[model samples]
Each structure stands twice: as C-alpha cells, then as structure tokens.
Target: MKKYIIAGLLAWLPLAITVWVLRWVINLLESVFDVLVQGAAAILPLSTHDVLHQLVEIPGVGVAILLSLLLLTGIFVTNFVGQWSLRQWDALVSRIPIVKSIYTSVKQVSDTLFSSSGQAFREAVLVPYPHAGSLTIAFVTGRPSGTVAEHLDGEYVSLYVPTTPNPTSGFFLMMRRADVIPLAMSVDEALKYIISMGVVAPTAEGLASAPQTTRPAGL
Candidate 1:
C-alpha cells in the first residue's frame, strides 16, 4: 500500500504543480487586462468602454496579447536605439544609493542563468563537502576570481551546494579542481535529484562515469 501511494504521488505531483503554475500565470495576465479595461472605462464613451471590456474578458485573449507584447519588446530591445535607451535607464539605477547593488546582483545572476555565453551553474559536480565522509552534488558556477582567487590554491572551481527540496538557497564553495569530482549528470538531472530529495536517481547508464573514490585529508 505504501509503495502504491508513493507511485501514485510520483505520477500526479508533477502534473499538479505544472497545472498550478499555468493557472497562476493565466490569472495574472487576466488581471492585467482587467485593469487596462477598468482604467480606460474612466475616460471613454460608454459604448466603446463596454466593447473593450467584453473583449478583454474573453478567455485566453489576455495571454495572447501578453505574448504579442513580449515578442514586440524583444524585437525592440535588439535594436541600437533601444539598447541605448536601456543602458541609460540602467545607468540611472546604478546612481541610486543601495538599489544599485541589489539590482546589479540580480541582473548578473539572471544573465548567467539565461544567457548563451554565461557559465554560471552549467555543470553538475560531486564533491566531498561539509565533511570527508559525505558527498554533495554541486553546480559549477565558474572559477573564482580577484582576491578570492588569489587565496585559493591552484585551479579551484566555484560551485554552489543546493539544499534538498528547496534549491533557491544554498552554500557557495570554492573547491580545488583536483578535489572536486565532476559528475556525468546534466544540470537538469542534478536539480531533479535535489528537488526530489534523492527519491529519483537516474540509472547508472544515464550518468557520466567518473573516478569517485574519496581520499583522506593529508594523504
């Protein structure tokens, strides 16, 4: 009975979460359309206002319009004038006290996660972290640099150790390249492992083959 229950949950939990996320996004888009219609009703003729409100209320129209707007924005941002305008806005944000550090850190993380060339959190690695007796999965963010790099021994990699079930927060460590064991698993597989709290491990054939023997300290 317990095995069956676990299997059933494994089948339905992902679907439930996906549906929940989609519903939340759709509701948010609908609210945006509703606000636009309500705001326009303040100044427009009654007949035109009713028409716009009815159109906005149609199911899925808000999502369609939102996607179209995003497409248009993407096109605009790729052009020279739009790039210049965005740079000026970023510069203004940088001049604001306290806001610049928060904004810059978020922007850099986003770029590293989403951009084609950025290397942050790209590789899955296995390391003896927190202690020699235990192994932890970590993501290779990149090699450390500047003053931190100077302190680390030759060829150290910067990586993050995410906690089970909640991956958004985790520890950042700079481990020696020789000490860190690079995993064969992709970033997505590693995430699934962490999120499922070790319940879902890929078959050995699916994982990368690597030397996993841990050495004692001072050896």
Candidate 2:
C-alpha cells in the first residue's frame, strides 16, 4: 500500500505543479488583454475598437506576446553594446557598500557559472560534504586564487553543491582536488538530474573515459 501511494505521487506531482504554474502565468497575461479591451471600449470609436475587440477575444495571444517580448529581450542583451552596458551596470553595483558585498559575490559566482568562459558546472564531480563518509554531488567551479589559495595547504579547487529540486542555489566549498570524484555526466544531464531530484537520471555516458585519479590543487 505504501509503495503504491509513493509511486502514484511520483507520477502526479510534477505534472500537477507544471500545469498549475503554466495556467497561472497564462491567466496573469490574459488579464492584460482584458484591461486593453476595457480601455478600448470606453475611449475608442466603435469602428476602430472592432479590431481590438476581435483580437483581445482570443485566449492565448497575450501569452504569445509576453513570450515574444522575453525572447527579443534575451537577444538584445546578447549583443555587443548591450553586453557592455550590462558590465557597466555591474561595475556601478560593485561600488556600493553593503549592497556591494552581496551583489559582487553573487555576480562573481554567476559570471563564473554562466559566462562563456565560466568552467563552473562544465563538469560534474563527486565530493564528500556535510560530513565525513557521506558523498555529495558537486560541480568543479575552477581553482581558488590569491589569499585563499595561499591559506590552504594543498592544491584547492572551488566546488558547488547544488541542492535537490533547486540547482540554482547551493553551498560553495574549497576542497583538495584529490578528494573529488569526477562524475560521468554532462552539465545538462547533471542539471536535469538535480532539478528532478534524481528521478530523471540520464544513462548517456560522457565521462566514461575520465581517469579515476584526483584533480590537482589548482584546478
């Protein structure tokens, strides 16, 4: 009986949450169309309002517009001038006081993970975390540097331990390269596995040829 209940829940939970969130977003966007219709009805001449009336009556067009806007925004930010402006904005934020500490740290981590040159999450690794004898999933976030590297005794690399169901947030740690086990999974596959809470593990082999040797201190 317990096994059946667990199995049924596993099948239904993801579908239920996905449908609910998508419907909520659609409804929110649809409200914008409703406002446009009400405004047109009050002010526009009947002849001009006819097209607005007809168009706003459609169910999902507002959602389509919202998605299109987001797509265009993404494209715009990827260009040279937009990228430069974004960097300048970040530089301004880094000059603030309390905000600077939080924002700069977050920006560094995000850039290291999401930037084109970021190697963080490029490889899946295994490391003991939280406690000894307990292995946890980690991603190689590159080597430590400056004072941090000097303070540590051995070759150290940064690793991120992503939490289950939310891979965007996690704990960062510096560990000896020799202690990490490189996993046989691509970054995308590892992400899916983490977000799905291990339910969607992929069988594709990417790290099959990786040697079992530990990583050096720097990287």
Candidate 3:
C-alpha cells in the first residue's frame, strides 16, 4: 500500500509542479497587464476605465496582451531610439544611490548569465576546495579582478561551487589556473551531478575518468 502511494505521488509530482509554475507566471503577467491598462485608461475618462477594466479581466486576454507587449518591447529595443532611451533610463537609475547598487548588481548577474558574450559558467572544473586533498566541482565564472588578482600574481580562475539540492546559492572561490582541472562534461551536466549530491553522475564516461590535479610546488 505504501509503495503504491509513493509511486502515484512520484508520477504526479512533476506534472503538478510544472502546472503550478506556469499558472504562477501567467498570473504575474496578468497582474502587470491589468495595471498597465488601468494606468493608460486613467488619462482618457471614467467611461474608458470601465471598458478597459472589463477587457483586461477577460479569461486569458491579459496573458495575450502581456505577451504581445513583450514582443513589441523586444522589437523596439533593437532600434537606435530605444537603445538611447534604455541608456538614459539606466543613467537615471544609476544616480539613485541605494537603488543603483542593488539594480546594477542584479543587472550585472543577469547579463552574465544570459549574454552570449558572457564568460560566466562556461566551463566545469575540479578544484581542491575547503581544504587540500578535497576534490569539488565548480563552474568557471571568469578570471579574478582588482586587489584579489594583484595579490594572486599568476593566472587565477574564479569559480562558483554550488550546493546540493539547491544550486541557486553557492560559494565563490579563486584558485590557481594551473590547479584547476577541466571537465569534458557541459555546464548543465555538471550542475545535475552537483545538485544530486554526486549520486547522479555527469554522464557515464565523464564521471568515471579521474581528472589530473596540481600542487603548491616549490615556493
């Protein structure tokens, strides 16, 4: 009886989560769309507000409107005027002190993670972290910068060591470039291995072969 219950739950769990995520996204888009419509209508008249409120409330209309707006925004942002406007808006935000710090930090992360030219998380590496003789999987974020780089002298690789079951939070480490061992597996494959706590291997061959390491050498 217990086995049957567990099996049923296992079957339904993924589907349930997918549906919940989609519904949540749709609801959020709908809320944004509703606010935009109300704001636009406010300038016209009270009659315009009544009509738009009803229109925006139609079952899936807000979702459709929101998607259309995103498409238009994508198209517009590719043009010169839109680019100039974006720069202006960014400059305005940059002058806001506290908001600038938060916004810039988050924007930099988003750009790094999504930009085609981004070097972040482009490779999986093996490093002896926490202590010597311990091998851990980390994603290459890029090279070290500023004072940290100057102090390290030789080439160094910046890496993100993600935690198991929840990969969103992780530690950042800077290690000697020579000390890092590159992996054959892709970033996605490496992430799966990490998130599963090594129970899930990154492909049969990639995980099976032992990677070479480096030492502190004569200093």
Pairs in steric clash, model 3: none
- Arrange candidates by lDDT, highest first: which order? 1, 3, 2
lDDT of 3 by residue, 131-168 (tens): 77587889999998887778887899889998887999
Worst 10 residues of 1 by lDDT: 210-219
Model 3 residue 114 CA deviation in Å: 1.5
User: Pick by TM-score: which candidate is best?
Assistant: 3
- Residue-by-residue lDDT tens digits, candidate 1, 1-219: 999999999899989999999999999988987887788888898879778877886899878887898899888878999889889989999999899999989988888888889998788888787887788889989888999887876788888999989999999888888777767788888899999899889668546646646332542
> Pairing residues by index, what is the TM-score of model 1?
0.77
Query: Local error of candidate 2 at 44, Å?
Result: 18
The runs of at least 3 residues in candidate 3 whose Cα sits more than 4 Å from the true structure, single-residue gaps closed, are 41-44, 205-219
Between prediction 1 and prediction 3, the one with superior lDDT is: 1
Pick the lDDT winner.
Answer: 1
TM-score of 3: 0.83
> lDDT of all the models against the reference?
0.84, 0.80, 0.84
RMSD of each: 3.7, 6.2, 3.2
